[model samples]
Target: MADTPNSPVVDAQLRRASVQERLGALEVEQARLRQELVSLSGELRLPGLYLTLDAAGTSALLVADAVQEVVRLVELEPLPGAPPHVAGTFIYRGSPAVAVDLAVLLGVTREPALDAHLVICKGARPVAVLVDRVRDLVEAPVLVEGTPDGDVALPWDGTGLMAGLCRTPEGIRPLLRISAVLVGSEET
Candidate 1:
């Protein structure tokens, strides 16, 4: 009603701005929903030893006094007829070991260039999970449900990587899924 000539242009601009605002609102709503879902499902924190290493040796997380110790040496073997993510197989404590590239397989930037450690998970299939550094292992909460950021957070049907986050002195630690790492892409 204000003006006849400028109304069309003004209307078009207003419509465009409204669309953009709606899109932004949708994105924010989606993020909030994801966070809520994750909170609802829940995650469990298990008590175990965290190991970190580098050119030097392995170190404990919880106990600061524990001196640096060398990771147990093992022989790596090729997982013949396996997937790409599968680094190889190794023998640890006189048992078959399935080695995987922690960074590449898990979608990390790269192989932990610095410190590396093996997380020994004892379960149906005892396996050692390779990690850049074993940041302290505090009680980590579980992610009940949420839209993960990307494949890195939920790789291979939510199988490749671990779930939940652990806050440590070093930084936020991603709870590595021993099962996912053990299975590799082949299973996915």
Candidate 2:
């Protein structure tokens, strides 16, 4: 007997082929998007891409290359005698990383949201920075010193915490100095 178009086997086969075709088209689109990202990065003259996040209601940017991963808020082991900004420590990839709350670092007294995220940063001193949410991946543009007038201001004193300020379509935001946040956490 020959399989008919309306038969269960033929219907299943047609569905499978249709799904495969859609997947192939999606793969091509993904590749095109990736190439466009690289081209945009080159045009922007950024050393690497940046990740934007909401830190205590303040918009900030972090170097994407320095970030190892972003994970959901996990229970942490308490660190006695650690700075106020230091929330606790969590194990990551067989290593313990101190979790620093960006909200506390920015002088916000409120607790982190229930759905907060931890942005694990890679460096000589690895630390997981807690943020309210991960916003988007952006290309770093030319930076200017100090906050520009009418721009969103840094919540904290900034001092060494902020590397500089950069303009985005949303407005001006602080480019956080990861090294400062890392080292400052240790010294304080």
RMSD, every candidate, angstroms? 19.0, 17.1
**Per-prediction count of colliding residue pairs?**
9, 0
Candidate 2, which segments miss by more than 4 Å at Cα? 1-45, 150-153
**Model 1 C-alpha lDDT per residue in residues 81-151, reported as the tens digit of each score:** 87655556666666665655555564444534444555555533345555456544343233233333433
lDDT of 2 by residue, 1-188 (tens): 88998999999868755664564455446435543654566332245688998888878888798798999989878788888889898888888788988888878867777899999988645588999999898775544444567555557444546655666767766777676566544543
Best-performing candidate as measured by TM-score: 2
Mark the regions of model 1 whose C-alpha exceeds 4 Å error after superposition.
1-75, 108-115, 139-160, 169-171, 185-188
Model 1 error, position 41 (Å): 12
Among all windows of 10 consecutive residues in model 2, the one with the lowest summed lDDT is 38-47
**Roughly what TM-score does model 1 have, to 2 decimal places?**
0.46
- Model 2 misses residue 57 by how many Å? 0.8
Pairs of residues clashing in candidate 1: 37-145, 38-145, 41-144, 42-142, 42-144, 43-142, 53-115, 53-116, 77-89
RMSD of model 1, in Å?
Answer: 19.0
